[model samples]
Target: MDTTLRHGPFVMQLGSMPVQNILVDKEWNIKQFIEVQSICSLPIELMLPPSWITGKDIDKLLSTEDDRLQICYRQFAHTLRHEEAKRPLLPNGRLHSDTLIDGLHSSKFWLLQALQSSGNPLHTFRRVKGYGDNYAGKGKPLAAAAFRPQIYDYLKYKIASYVDYRKDVQKLFNGEYGRVYDEEDLDYIRRRPIVPERK
Candidate 1:
């Protein structure tokens, strides 16, 4: 089986890569992904530094006064802004579904992890509070309030089930996500307990 194919510079086809060979989670890898601008401007994107390096490392990098990690939330928070990120909700309220999808994929690994278990991270994009003129998420009754935490919460639920990932991770990695959660299956994961029921 040919495993390597290289194009000009952007396309490298690793044909039929096995499941386990793909999805991998490492603290250093996540931090590196952030530094590479590959996972920019998402909410959990801020937490990557702390998870990969140290929370103090983040404070140090963003700190101004005396370069002290002593206590600096403002600068640290500002680093997470990706130009359009802080834009206020439109006059009324609304989050474009496509924009929501962008936000979800921005945290690609996060979505992958979420799908590994019982959560559907993409659906949470609805919680982002869609409003204002021609709010794109309006007609798409699927998206919620456009809240970032909703996305994080879903991811957290999947991560919390760390006893081991569900075998379904394979099907998810196959990239048929849209088909797997067709409109009818959207909220299936929401009802699943975030944390396992205490025995």
Candidate 2:
């Protein structure tokens, strides 16, 4: 009955077997596995502000002297850049996959909400064309053109699903994410609805 060995600083442990065999299969406390990082706060700023979420005119707010969007957008972009800069760069001058996932996690959350509601918060803030659209790669596939947004859309689909989103969010909090989808999965996701059937 000994839950003796702890994993790192987390409370997760391997329980000893009834027959006193240390070689027995490890029993994992799933609740502890989740609770290990439950204390960590989600990136609340990554979510759109209340006004934006409630269908207010974010573009007008951004245009006016009101600095809400300005301040929040600046912090969001700064955190994104900081996270990207901390990651190892690739030969193609792009940041690591971690940067891409972090960016998409934030982007998909904000953009999907905007797309479902009234205004385009991230798009208006960044002044990007079709930021969240073009999921099927409608145009050129080069660089950050249609291809990037397509991948972004795919990730958005993955995130919109509750089960997958929880896994990704857990990984996001843990500062690591495995591949959520593959090429075959992408083909199927593209054929499916843009907004996932579930939250």
Candidate 3:
């Protein structure tokens, strides 16, 4: 009956002398319980940026190089974020699981799209090899052995300071944030094969 004591889907109680409100549900569950004795209240904490921002940055970086390169980088970044987000947030400050899962999904989608668009065996092979190396670290040596000569030739003539960007990127993430995948996490990601088609 009192305006100060509001009740609808939820209840809110306000006092005149003391500026404070108590919120509760019909079941008496404390949906929100706040005590304000003064004119000021606790400062609100800011939310962290969505993990996808990193992936988007990588995409922008690669977009200027080559279409294929752009696609590969975008997919990789997206996949990594998606996968990381999907995982349950660990107390150890690792990435969120759901992010990683979603990132991987985006990566796979883009990878397939790039392959289809390029229709170049070498590019496809290199991209796949990169993805494989990222997880298993098995195909890297072979990919390097095969592609190094061409990559070297490409870099030799150009003055675009050549370096293992993948390694650099990984290191950057690790140093700034933390390890994206530990031994156990890698094993889990590897074991969960991405089916070609959704069932």
- Please name the candidate that would achieve the greatest TM-score relative to the true structure: 2
> What is the C-alpha lDDT profile of model 3 across 50-147, one tens digit per residue?
22233332223243444544455456545656665665223344443333344344443234333333233333333432343332334333334333
In angstroms, how far off is 13's CA in candidate 3?
A: 52
| Model 1 clashes, total count | 19
Top-scoring candidate (lDDT) = 2
The 10-residue segment of model 1 with minimum total lDDT is 1-10
TM-score of every model? 0.15, 0.21, 0.16
Cα lDDT tens digits for candidate 2, 1-199: 0122122122222221111222333563222222222233222222333334223444444435335554554565566557657762233444333333454445443343344333333344243344534432454332343235556566667767977778879997675865666789989988987775665
Instruction: Arrange candidates, best lDDT first.
Output: 2, 3, 1
Which residue pairs does candidate 2 place in steric collision? none
lDDT of 2: 0.42
Give model 1's TM-score versus the native structure: 0.15
When 1 and 2 are scored with lDDT, the better candidate is 2
